[model samples]
Target: MASDPFDRPNRNSSSFILVGVPSLETSPICLGILFCSGYIITLVGNGGVLLVIGLDNSLRDPVHCFLGMLAVIDVVMVTTIVPKMLSVFWLNSTQISYMACFVQMFLVHSTTSEESGVLLAMAVDRYVAICHPLRYQAILNRQTIAQIGLAIVVRALLFMDPLTGMVTKLPYCHSHVVPHSYCEHMAIAKLACANPRPSGLYSVAGSSLIVGMDMAFIAVSYGMILKTVLGKKSCWKAFSTCGCHICVILLFYVPGIVSIYAQQFGSGISVHAQVLLADLYLTLPTVLNPIVYSMRTKQIRQAVLKMLFSRKVHA
Candidate 1:
């Protein structure tokens, strides 16, 4: 009797379990602990950011309005990737159905693009507030913010749709072991039987369009912010307003640029090392963003403390 491909071990069939790969070095127990800790911290921190913004009426201004959106985007970004990654780690299974993998990839890319758009919106908000103070209130109304948010969501969805289609069309010839914890687009593209050059090019071009445009807008906004701040007499106040944003901008951009270069050009680093770095890039912003805003923004800090106290008293 002839054996089914699924019955044979590592037969390069469309089995749900992508087999024939060496397991990662980390113990499942240790990986589980770390992953859980990261997830909890990310959730708590981003949740706090949302709560503080929503409850504190004073933070409903244009600048914080954008900050709140940024926090929401971060929450989506972390939630999309981290939980699935933890499952992959703890279960010790690198297997994902082609459809499931494409979905995950789509969500990750969508959230990432949304985040970039939010950052760009925030920078524009800052520019209006600082550089065009006379027209700030008139220009950055609630309706405008709502429109920006909608635009971000729509743009992210559209930008990622092409890559998702490309990935799903590619033939998977049984070598489905994803080296990373998550179903990264590039990693999956590498495993396809057909030439993924077109997908690769599209991915790179999309990244350039999104990241490049965002960075350029942020740069121009900050340039005007810098000029306005330096021209003002209250230098300290101006610096304080922009300080948290500056930290977040650096946190978001530096790792992103490095990862792009590493993936595209660097050869000295191992894939495992690159994977670890990518994990860091994914996690650090979620962990640090709330801390930056809470510690730096006195209003948010006081609001958080008041909310905690109120909760305790109610309890």
Candidate 2:
């Protein structure tokens, strides 16, 4: 009680059990294979993006830098949750130690919050490029970009630190069985012997203030970008520049909002459907982010293609 259990976990059992996709009980093998394929695709795509960006000196613009950052975020995000989910499905090994659960929940939440901030930063980069093209380089130089990255990291750390403390301090008593596929704040907190209301409230507040503010900033940035490029050709080009990022944003945030709302308010949707939505929110972006960026951004595609071609030539 004096110090948090996160200093060391005290648990009812040796490990917590994850009841992953109860709906897949009849077809666990197939579901596991599907998820494994998804995870592999995500790795290959994002890895390729990172490789392309790192190899090309000409592609070192702020946009490319952010793309690499996003790829890293997507990679880490999937790595945090998907492996355990796959293990649960394939190996029937659902028991995760409390410390492991704590680590997973921390990485998952922090990376998610950081990615939201990165999305806002990307919007700002686009706004500068479209509206203040002449000043874009001066405004978003390497130092400035580094500063933005640092700020995003610190913001994520500060925002999620309290939530981690709240979730970790609670005494988990008899029930160590988490109903979900992976360790999340609510899932872990519900196992606590003490009240879990504060953890839930903290999560809701974190989503509203952290994610909500980032979305608001991105929206305002895009609005200004639209005004700056209102003419026929300018409008097309400007929107073209940001089109991929917009799609990625929508993919990342919209499903999460819908899933949260459905879970909270939509009585008509089934529990399994809600869980599926939650899973998709994390996995969908990882799978599609590279495709959307590489296809829409010509420079990225060219860079990736050139690198692959050279590798094949040397081999």
Clashes of each: 0, 0
lDDT of 2: 0.82
Ten contiguous residues with the weakest lDDT in model 1: 13-22
After superposition, the stretches of candidate 1 with alpha carbons farther than 4 Å from their true spots are: 1-24, 27-31, 231-233, 240-244, 264-266, 311-315
| Overall local distance difference test of candidate 1 | 0.74
User: How do the residues 27-114 of candidate 2 rate in per-residue lDDT, one tens digit apiece?
Assistant: 7788788778889999999998888888788899998998889889989999999999989888988889878998998988788888
Model 2 scores worst on lDDT over the 10 consecutive residues at: 4-13
Instruction: Give every collision pair in model 1.
Output: none
- Write model 1 residue lDDT over 1-315, tens digit each, in one string: 887643444535552443211255456567657767877987888888888888888888876876687777777777877776666556655467666777778987787788788878878887897778899989999898889889999999888888888888988765556666677777778777788778877887888888889989988987788788795686777676667777777777666656555665557877766666666666777788777755566778788889899999999
- The Cα local distance difference test for each model comes to 0.74, 0.82
State which candidate has the highest TM-score.
2
